[model samples]
Target: MTPPLALDIDGTLTTPSGRIDPRVFELLPDWDAPVVFATGKAFPYPVALAHFLGRPEFVIAENGGVAYVDGETAVLGDPTAPRAVVEAFRERGGEVGWGDGDTVNRWRETEVALSLDADEALLREVAAAADGDVTVVDTGYAYHVKSPAASKGKALERVADALGIATEAFVAIGDSENDASTFAVAGESYAVANADATAREAADVVLDEAYMDGTETVLAALRERGE
Candidate 1:
């Protein structure tokens, strides 16, 4: 059997503005392999995408705080991060937009998606305010305030176990800092040409194209290898 494909949705499979390029759909290989989405997008987004794909295999959402598969959803990480953390950041004059009741953040169980500029110092202060129990992950699009245990790699392990597939029987692809964990754990990891330096360093293969074009490139390579 072909190994499952674990994909990061945002910069890995969509345009910079997060739209799926129609050309990407055209390039999708005709295969029965499981296509698991490992992303920081909220639960509903990935679930809807899976439904559109006609294959709702598995989804790792909110940077591994949640997992959905086979009509069942599970919280994979601790949901105890204090809500005051966001307030504290705001008090410190950090611009933060919470995704609590929004379309994407509503489905998040533990993590709080904060739409803000990437300020490492401010993020560190926010993490400290949470008593070090929460960590800030820069997902390229936003900073997620989540438990230290939340990670895409851990989610992949859980999904792989459920599918009865070895960890080595998977291909992981992404384009940002949060994706570094997925790249580290995948059997074969790939990054699009536009991926950040950290992701590029972690990947075994880096495609020349960007976004969905890069995704198509990797999928084609995987198909060739399987052939």
Candidate 2:
């Protein structure tokens, strides 16, 4: 059976500055398998990254709250909180804005990329002001506020359902706090050398080297799996 693979963009497939490694780019066209771009980035960001990775047919973006299949966007469940929830969070003296892929992310002439944890007092205050059901995940960059039900694992399940494959057929790779759940649930998982301690703990394998080499490592793993 051919294995299905999912790749994270930022620190896995690309450099810290977001450039795709040329050597890895050369290998992508020769790669075989149903590869998915599972990233915390938004639509266009991941799309650009996937284009670099050989235009994968399926993508799980916005931390798995949003999915793009054959170029169509399918929002599975509520990835973002309701307007009221956002309002309540703001009421608690916390500044909330749209992040990375947030279509509604319009703030200070810059695209909102989520929230930063400035102080524990502020974190508690924002958590309290929001609807009790909000899911606040640490994405290394910021506090990702979403519905408790939205996650990369759930998004992977959707892709599996669409492909008529079991969850065990998937391999997930990532390198940050946001990738924890995705890594935790995948049949096989890998963490890049640049991954933080939290990401390393959740992964089955810690990549032996940094970003560019990590892509090569992942491709090697895929080839071994007969992808």
Best by TM-score: 1
TM-score of each: 0.90, 0.79
What local distance difference test score does each model get? 0.79, 0.68
Residue lDDT tens for model 1, 1-227: 45688899899889878797775456543455888888887888878777777676589998888887766677887866734676677787876664345565666677777775545588677779667788887777888888888788888888878888876788998998788888888899999998989899999988899998888887877778777
Backbone clash total, candidate 1: 0
lDDT of 2 by residue, 1-227 (tens): 44677777778877777676677568665556677888766666666666756666688877777777765667764533434454555676656544455553431111123556434355545656665656555666556556666677888878777777777777878888777777866788888899888889999999888776876777776787673
Worst 10 residues of 2 by lDDT: 104-113
TM-score of 2: 0.79
Q: Which segments of candidate 2 are over 4 A away from where they belong?
A: 51-56, 70-72, 79-112, 115-121, 224-227
135 in model 1: Cα distance from truth in Å? 1.0
lDDT of 2: 0.68
- Kindly report which residue pairs in candidate 1 clash with one another: none
